[model samples]
Target: MYRNNKSNLKLMRLLPRIGVICCIALLLTAAGCSRVEKAEKDDKILIGLSLDSIVVERWQRELEILVATVNELDAEIDVQIANESIDKQTEQIQYLIDKNVDVLIVVPNDANAFYDVLSEAERSGIDVIAYDRLIMHPDVDLYVSFDNVEIGRGISQRLIDELKKKTVNIPEEEIKPFKLLIINGDPKDNNSKLLNEGIYASLQEYIDAGFVTVVDEAWANEWREKIAKDLVEKYLSSGEEIDGIIAANDVLATGAIEILSKWRKAGEVLVVSQDAELSACQRIVEKTQLATAYKPIYDLASTTAKIAVSMAKGEKIIANDSIYNGYDNIPYLKLDAYVVDLDNMDNVIVKSGFHRKEDIYRNINNGK
Candidate 1:
């Protein structure tokens, strides 16, 4: 009887083990079904956006408009912001690729980086769109941005006009050559190069004619405010006479303005900038900065979102222009850009509903 009781105890233990195995099997089956269901849902089309950095106000606006547009299309989009890290961005792209995203939109930190990984994504049948900044990769499917070159030209032209006004009182022969400083954006950014190209093109005649001279040039890393401020301060402390500055973007412009304002030279030095950030517009009203090249963020972001969704749905993409990225004439959708000064700030920025009038004119009386 003791032996029989021991045998029953062993069977009871075996019964518990068997029940545990059955429970595990059921759980595994449920997990497999969940994955299959997710796979089926992913078939509807998935878009992955890798933003270089939204640390700037401009990029934040870009993200907001892009997400709103994607939701309107009833499409799914996953976004990853790299905050200006190439390695982190590469890893993010890989994760999206592993998720089998149908389309990948990348605003690359470095134009030269990500050619190989983006190529792999292309090989996997994922459409890649270069957002805002051009990705110098042959595998990139499309480039969407405003005319950066035109923005450069516009800002440069505005500087030249302002310089002329500042020099108009002097005799033609006695006019001091206008000394201009060039504070470019991140060297790794392709848009910086394009902006420089346009600026140089527009200012070449004046430079050659000796009416203007580039006194100093520096490239701000990552468009960091402190770096730009230090560069400008160092130049100013050296007792250099700076009549004008062509700061690549508003953030860099802010740095230069801070230094110039501290030195009490903000009114004398003509500063040209881009991005039309709210602070820059206020500075324009304050007459501390000159014109800003305003590229409508909503237009660029909404259009890019639409393209990504359509491409994900296997539709044809028609580009308005072509840019050769060393390997191919990559299709491009270039949008228009405008120069905004205090005079038309209302027409361009406020009327477009981009910014509330009260916000832009916060520091000024009706933006003067």
Candidate 2:
């Protein structure tokens, strides 16, 4: 009984200390859990944006809008510009992958260059969105862009309509066929291919009927204005009369117009292009360029940003269309494009706040 009492006393004395130790451990565990919960709550979704290049004016605008939208959603974005280099773009993508970004948005310089790296991104459970330009990989989670084919058709139709108006008073058979020179975008870009398809499709009937002739068709590598200028210069120097030009975008249009200006044919030859760039809009109002296909950048950038955020949060995305990328059909969200000309330039470009009215007409106003 004495021994039992002694042992009981010892245990009783140690019981409070043991209880205190247990309490401290429990409190530490609770603090650790609380910190983990707080960290999780504070974690922001990180989206990686890999761009082909920001050389085009519209791309910089698009980036601004995208950044604004992403910030509005309380997410983060890592942007990398590859400057139209395929190898550099691949390196940037690998860097993004290593960063373990929750989502990746790519404006691919070349559609076919990202299969392996993008596949690795998917393997790591990251969602991928192809922005403006389509990635040829099947594993791309989504594609967001404007209707490029329609823009092509619309611009081509504008050129055709203008040419028709010029010869409206003459007999159809008496009118000579219009000679058209096509300055297409980078051949590596899938959008360029689609645009070319739409351009050819629109001109096919007129071509077959001997109403139009494609005098020369050239692809500008990397959509470089210098290359387009050189090509136009060569054609003009060869004594080939170019009645009209269908440049793939504003940059190419600028190049063509520069050469035409040197030949004193700026306003004489009808030129149409895409991307409602400020210079192109200015040219439209100045009677240098006929029209520009306006693809709303805010709509495209905002929608892409929202979709990227939703994807990062593991939310469902609803796409109204799909495009086959030579591997499999991927979800596509296409926006509309409008033709901006002298008639509706204010309504489309200015009204949307894409470009200020004064800025677009700066030169014309100054001349006046």
Candidate 3:
């Protein structure tokens, strides 16, 4: 009984110390978990930007401006380039969705290809913004880009105006209808169809008047420069007389211009395209390309970033316009576009600091 009593006393004495040790360990573990939770709660807002492709120079500029704007707004951006592949873009979007991004911005390679994935994103509670190109899905929260129809109108009008200038001295009745070649962008892109609508609308009056004839027109696959080059080459090789070309964007314009150059007809054939890429601007100054439709990228990118941040924070977005995406109306915020040619290139492009004057005029004598 004495031994049993002694052992009981010893165990009793050690019980409080073991309890204290356990209490201390529990407190430490709780503190570690709290720290982790707090860190996660304080993480910066993450914006997932899925781009169709950065193959074009303008897209690089837009990316730089978007990153800068997002950083300025105290948010983090994750960019994924799809290289103009619909399947790849869809997969990238899924990855972003799995990452649980606060906001998802997509410059879709194919407007209609993301219906299922975008639906998945919405189901996951992620806000989707169709950047530059409209995603055909109705679940898209916002569509931010320039007025694409106006861009088409502006570039087409420029083509018509240039043709008018070339035949000014000749009588209207005696002048033959100018032969025009239309090299449109990827058919899968919604913007391309909208652009064609505007192009045909702008050219209707001229076409009715028998002033312009579309000799050959085709949609370039993936907006590939080589595809555009091949299209123009094939047309020229058939001995067809092409007086003007309406290239959908600068990349296509570059391809078309290359074929024209090979035929020693670069400046002789009037060509107009969209997206004021640096190379396109240089071509304009060199008289190889007549004009380009310049969408103010800084304004577009900054506005998109701000809207995206606002959407991420559950803030209300005020948009004056909305567009129907085949199912529902989506908030549309459009910016203006400008026509950039030699006459106003200095004022619009160089003055805006979009490109350096020296770089645009590098190939020209006396920087004319």
Question: Candidate 1: minimum summed lDDT over ten consecutive residues — where?
Answer: 1-10
Clashing pairs in 3: none
- Model 3 reaches what TM-score against the true structure? 0.87
Q: Per-residue lDDT for 1-368 in model 2, tens only?
A: 11244335435544565576556556678566665445444567889999999989999999999999999999999999998888999999999989878789999999998889998876666778999999998678788998889988999999999998988799777999999999999999999999999899899999998989998888988888987788789888888888999999999999999999999989898999999999999999999999999998999999999988987665677588999999888888989999989999999999999999889989985733
Q: Which digits, one per residue and each the tens of the lDDT, describe model 3 over residues 106-130? A: 9998888889999887676677889
Q: Against the unseen true structure, what C-alpha lDDT does each candidate score?
A: 0.85, 0.87, 0.86
Kindly give the stretch of ten consecutive residues in candidate 3 with the minimal lDDT sum. Answer: 1-10
Off by over 4 Å in 3: 1-41, 366-368
Q: How many Å off is the CA of 233 in candidate 3? A: 1.8
TM-score top scorer: 2
Candidate 1 C-alpha error for residue 259, in Å: 0.3
For candidate 1, write residues 216-328 as lDDT tens digits.
78888888888778877987899888889999999999999999998999967889999999899888878999889888889899999998888766568858998987788
lDDT of 3 at 194: 85
Name every residue pair that clashes in candidate 2: none
Per-model TM against the reference: 0.87, 0.90, 0.87
